[model samples]
Target: MDSHPLKTLLHHHLASDASAVQHVPYTLASLTPAALLPSPHSSKWSARITSLLHAKTSDARWAGLCLAQKSALLSQPVMIESAQSWIAVALPLLAVRSLFLPRLNLMYLRTKRKESPPVLRAAIRLLRVIFTTATEMPEFQRQVATPNVAKFTVALISLVETCLDEELKILLLSTLTRIIPIYPTLHRPHQPALTALCFVYLNGNACKPPNAKLTTAASQLYAVLHLTGGKVGAANLWRKAVDDALDFGWTALSSIRTTFLADGRLPQVQSASEPITSVPLNLDRLRCCIVILGDLFSAPVHRLVQVPLGALVKFALALLTCSKEEKVETHLDPTTRMMESLATPRIWALSCDLITALANRQVFLGEAGPVHLTTLQSFGSHLTPSAPRIATCIAFQLEQELTPSERLPFLDALEALFSRCYTTHATLVVNRLAKTVLPCASSVLSQQEETPVVELESNGRSKKGKRVRDFEGDEVFKIRQVVCPTTVDGQIVLRAFAVLQLLLRNGGLSPALQSIVCRVCLSALLALAQMTPASLSPDVRLHALLSATIQKTCVEFASASVDGLSKSLGLIVSTCLAAGTLQHEIEYLLHPRLPPLLRTMPGIEALSLFRTEESEEESHLIKSFGLASVAPSAPPVVRAGSEPVTLLPKRQPTAPAAQPLAPAVEPPAALIFRPTPPAPKPPLKAPSPALKVGPAPAEAPTLPVPMDVEGDETNEDMPSIDLDSDSDSE
Candidate 1:
């Protein structure tokens, strides 16, 4: 088989060959170490490779860079230790995952002195890439299995434990999550030691700050460990601790966390999705608690059902409500308020997360009928009375926080309430949400007014350095700061838009009301898009969605005036075009991909073939409605939109004449090609043959009896009745 292209590239870079591109194909494919396997001289190779680590010469540094790429792309069991030692020295250099200096650019690539960060990023990225390959690609898993890769796993586990930076910890945890599951016996996670640190990844930091990859990694890890190892090894110990803690019902982690949720049992997961097998290890404590609880539910035939569902929900509610670190509102100053405003909902969100996870677990477990729904019902039963309070909390949090990460759980809780008991609680939640967001909806998109600078007292002493001001106390400044849309802004907009969209779709609001709110949504979105540059993903997406929402609802609420709808549509479309992305409607119009019609018919006339009978009368109906006031088929002098002068048949007070029309003589039989007429159904009143067969041609009138040019002959012809009347009067 031909050598992989990335391998060729790495080899050429190691050889410091500029002409290597000519020798080897320079195509980019997925980078993997499988091709770089089988180092026969593995023992002696590290000594020779270590010289490249100093990277003194340009070619040597190039070789080091190549080696870093190789370490990421090409480590098998034979070279794992050597690669690790090399990685240790070069770990700090792994700063850039996507840097590519072409082999052709030897001078620039070689002469670069700063190499550590790049090497470090390359190393970390390699961990990610390899972990991904091992997890996804079975070939790598089967072919690359080694007896001693556990040593490397242990080192990585240690690194994850000690790593301070969330990014690095994430990288390490992600690597371990993949490694643990495939070779469960290699390490004690599924075998060696499924460390608490690993489980912690699924909590606050992983789930909320929303390091999605990390969270996913951690979740996968836990699930994999649970499924493969089946609560054996260190997994059993962790499970036991959770089982013991929950054996006696505890309301919320708060009641138990201080005493029972110790570091040994408790993980520090800031947020989760990451599992030991799937999620990155988070350092957050609360995240660990929830993740462990989740693991308990995940295990086969556990004690979760024994616990009251109300207890779980109430615990979640209390945790969600009280988790806000800030107590007593700080209305002190703009800076303080703003800082408080943007902070996330914290562990309270995590508590809600646990409830959601529990609910999901019940759903997936499905050992019995309707267990998940029952759990949700229990949750709603408790939430119904506190609906207003929960609704208020949700609304306030949405307003206060900039990041939607922490708000997600609260939103989940609200969704739970809605789904479980929409009648009593859904309206409360939705109304609060709409009321909170609607006021700011327009203002967030509004143009900023310049704030006048306040007069500062002259201190006379020259300031030594540039002073950065956090807040200047002007309404405009505060407004600008508040409205400066970011990912968080996009999230809120999406959420609010989602609520309105749902309401619009589910017939949540009346038609007239729906139209009005839809208009508001469109207007607000337009203002947002206008203020927002299309370069931002959220902004572009919001604009795209705004266009879509309008389209979906416009047809639904047909009572809306066409002129207003047109203006609204024009606003969104023009804004998108202005922003440089084509509007969706315009895209469809310009390239209508309708199914092909039968080609037997010619050109546009084929459309007439499928016309419905009602469609034929559409023009008449249009004319009747006064819409087609000035007919296009009318005289050229007539203007469009003019009131049509319709000639209606005169109405008769009496019923229609029932006299039968004189039957017409049949045409001569010689015209044999003519179509035969069919007998028709009886009519209510038979029309005259003149009406049925159309008026017969009138006979040529006899020329008026010759009238004298200027005499009584004319008078005699004028009418004997008038002359006789005169005679009789005389």
Candidate 2:
């Protein structure tokens, strides 16, 4: 009877070698101990399998060959091969169907997890192939409009997602976001996928669109709204989307506008077939329009300089009234309702950009007065309650006008806005207000100081008791905090210092010094310089800002005489020398401050004194002073045998003079050598005839006097001159 050798079959074919057959079969009934068996082939088999799996493929046949070799019971070869092919086909599908995945996943999980197609492995493999193909195939472009291609693409995405392990889900989502927009599909059913793509496509070009597929997608609006991170995000994204849409084509914009204008209504994302009372404006769309108008206002004045006044007015009005309702009341939190109300969404940033544009060519507004200025006047009032930062931004914008007095109401509104900002937290708004208001603060403070005194009643006669005078309004210098108030966060403090630095560098310091403002300014600088690392670690930027301000203060003080600046400079220098001051703190002092102060103080007397007292040892400091004027080269001595030729004495000491027999006779007063009295300074020559331009003289007899005009004559005692041809001989 023929019987299969199961052991041999298992060892030879499964173990990757014929050598496995040499092992004893069943150990010959186990009576004697079997000779030690050969090493197991498991390790070698594993290595061989790994190599095969990693082997490069020259063609599809390589995959086919790999499939042929893998044992059927041991592996799923077909599944592996299909995974390879799926990568190439799925990439574009994922790109196009990218929007639908999230929603479909939600639906499938809720109602059809078991029924959903088992395409995850196939999907992942296909995605790999597609990415590879994209890099390799130069001519493979996506065909977004074709239904066949779109459907296939969607199927591929669905497959890859189903097979992806949970650990890779986030990574897969990220990849799909980049890949999906490449196919650019607009299927209505694929809204969720498109939304997902938008979340991923932080700055995608498709974001600008009149494309029906994108417009029809239910989640598009939300995706756009949520695209940016928060309040600022909404403002930024809204601006970006409208700008992108405008760039895509004016016709697309016109279509959107025309649809809204028809029947004088805003178009709702919801279907026309659905019952409708009023199509409430989509906050997303409203925000987008606001951003577009904002862009118009904020862009360079020249860009809109030529825009017809009538058109500008019309667009402005349209933007102001675009919303379906008169105002936007978003309940952002349980306690606070943010009302995005506007005569238009006009605010400081908008005012600055727009008014600057109009004022660039004020004549246009002049011609279009009441109608034009009316809108601007309205805008200013509307923005009156805006943030201090916003108010400042707007004020700077209008400041370019030849006379801000023309816009007094607007200025008043700005004052009110800043006043409110100040009341919230004194320091909070000071730094912000300082940017614009500081420029004019001296005048403002002067006016304030005078007003309080005017309210005081003066008694001509002396009273028994002291009289009370109202200097109430003159106290702008006093920050409410006396003792160190709760310290501000580092960033805020840095910003405050930055603003102060700007004020000092720009034109404000002179005025500040001349007015009572100097005290507050000094206090601010001291606060900055004295700030400790424990309180607010000096970052490089904050340090630089403080250094610059200190230098400016030093420069201002430099203009004063030593006595005039003594107290102020002392305060400043001491403040800088306070505990946390670094070496950089003294750097500014040397450049312009200390040098000028030293010059003014009778030859560096003050700094010399300061240096002397501060040295590590008192005796050493005294020694330094005694040695200060000593030359680097040692003192000269007369050497023997060379006509009293001077030589620098060597550092070695001479034997102590033999103890003087009588108390050491004081050293004989050496012949004091004084520089020969400057050769009796040649008598000032009387004005020469040529220099005096005397009357022309009769020609004198011409004869050579043998004078040494070239300075060639030598005195009898002088060494004879040598005129060797070689320059070295001289």
Candidate 3:
């Protein structure tokens, strides 16, 4: 040029009067640093000028002004000192990546060698603001502002991507991530710069971009999917990325997978439509995606966006069928192929999680609803042997999310599937059956008595806690206990014992004539709390059920003869009594109805007999059957006129008396049973004449008048008949 424009501008500005500089505003038009390759003529003068610019200044304004003075101000300490002013002027102009800016950045990098990466990272961050504004500029303003800033950003990102230093690349990509949205146009454009950037970003070699960046990139790809008529521009991106990752040619896929699983927000990318990089939809990617989505759904309803649920399900479905080759065929071998055909842990976990999330919202469909039924029915038709288990696991998860009212229905649907899986199949281990139904029992129990308590605040106001006593939410003051039967191979196992004891002792189950249930219950109780753990997890519901189950079992068959009901009951009673938790249930069994049930139980009753010594017999029977007794020391037989005992009492044998008494046999068989009320005719005749005395008019005590058993000694020997049972129905 006539003279380098920056040099000419600087000379003109400097030659002007210092005071006049205040009013005269000068713009640097086409100002740029002189070439590092110097001309022979002005070399010494240029060197002097550079030295002066580098000199220290006492005045800040002077340094600021000098920074604004010319673009030739590189290499000056003043330029570094006047960062704020330099940024103001240079940011707009230097937004573009070119020879000049690269050299300037190199100089800045060299000068700030001692700064930490973070600090240097901060310095480059200013470029984001500049580029952001540059993209928004009007066409004419962009010309005046900065040229090719968008392309420059792409180039800058490319340079970072090519770098070997991982940390630097991460920093650079992070910056690019923020700046890229400045040109939303490139997000879909297949122009050279746009295409190059897509490859560089997708290649992800520089540093594993953060989850946020990957999310953004994913969103952009989705945008492209929507905007570009399903452009094949990105067709190659997904294949290349996934294939390269498989070969370890690129590690970004692994990093992205980690982020996809860990980040609950990735499902938000659903709005990003028509994603080109189906890398995220590949089997491994989908596995992580499902987990993350599930986690989000598992969170409180407020934490999840409602629409994402359907979209995610759709996305997962697409991925499952998208490949040209069957997914099973991709595995290394037959076994691997079989496992793939079945759900992997990650896949199973994903399915469970997704189903759980869907169920959490009462939005059961797909694997959580009717489709799940088909999945169950078809059990391994097209799937591997393990598929049945996977289906069960998924159903179990969905079942777990149903409200108490919904659980039975959910289970019913699942049970059909379970039945189809095989004659014997369970998502839960046998021991873990408690986990399944206890929650249902707990839900019922919670509803039975949710007495609200007021919680006072500092302001003297109060609030009621959630009605359900979920430990995850709030502490519950009361816990209701219930018992359920455990089944094994169509037979009641240890759980049946608990159930029988509960029915007999608590009177809780319906279908009152369930005689088979009783046998089932007794058999399980016979397991004697063996399968019951010594300690239980704090799954409040499960623990309560187990505790109640154990308590019922103990009280029911404690007197088993094999263990001898007394020994068994004693072990249970002592265990419970010593523990102090079973005292209440023990008291409940003392209800009038309980003892006979215990005494009549053949196995249980015989065991009670074993606990008693002849000397201790009557009292021992009273204690074991919990029968009320006249006295602790009362003999089993009462003496009246004292006849030696003919046989044991109908209930249980009693203790013998110390003395033998003479046989007081009735005078005659007829006399032994008194039936003679002379004749009712005497009552009328007596009332007519002799019976005019006092209450004699009561008519000879009324024929068929119930024998005054309380007053009659002979009647005393008669067992107390249950009068209520004798009452004829009207």
- Winning model by TM-score: 1
lDDT per residue (tens digit) for residues 1-730 in model 1: 9855444554553354343223222322333555445554344334545666664544454444454455455564534445445544443343221233241121221223444433434445544444444445465544443422443554455445544566666666666655654555545433325545544554444234455556555654554454234333434443444554343223224322221223334323232222331122222444555655665555343122333345555555555554233333323334322332322245566666665565455322235632332222243433445555556666766666444556545556554544443344355455446544443333343444443332212221114433223366544635334342566555544455544544443323333333334445544545545454453233556655654544443323322233433444555456556545545555543443442231111122211211131253433432332333221232212111322221212222232333324333233342122232422433223233222122233542111122111231122211112222466567
Q: Top lDDT: which candidate number?
A: 1
TM-score of predicted structure 1: 0.44
Scored by Cα lDDT, where does model 2 land? 0.33
Each model's total of backbone clashes? 59, 17, 12
Local distance difference test, each candidate: 0.42, 0.33, 0.34
Q: After superposition, how far is residue 124 of candidate 1 from its true place, in Å?
A: 8.3
- For model 3, the stretches where C-alpha displacement exceeds 4 angstroms are 1-120, 133-148, 164-182, 186-283, 287-343, 351-393, 397-730
Candidate 2, residue 119: lDDT? 28
Q: TM-scores, in order shown?
A: 0.44, 0.29, 0.28
Ranking by TM-score: 1, 2, 3
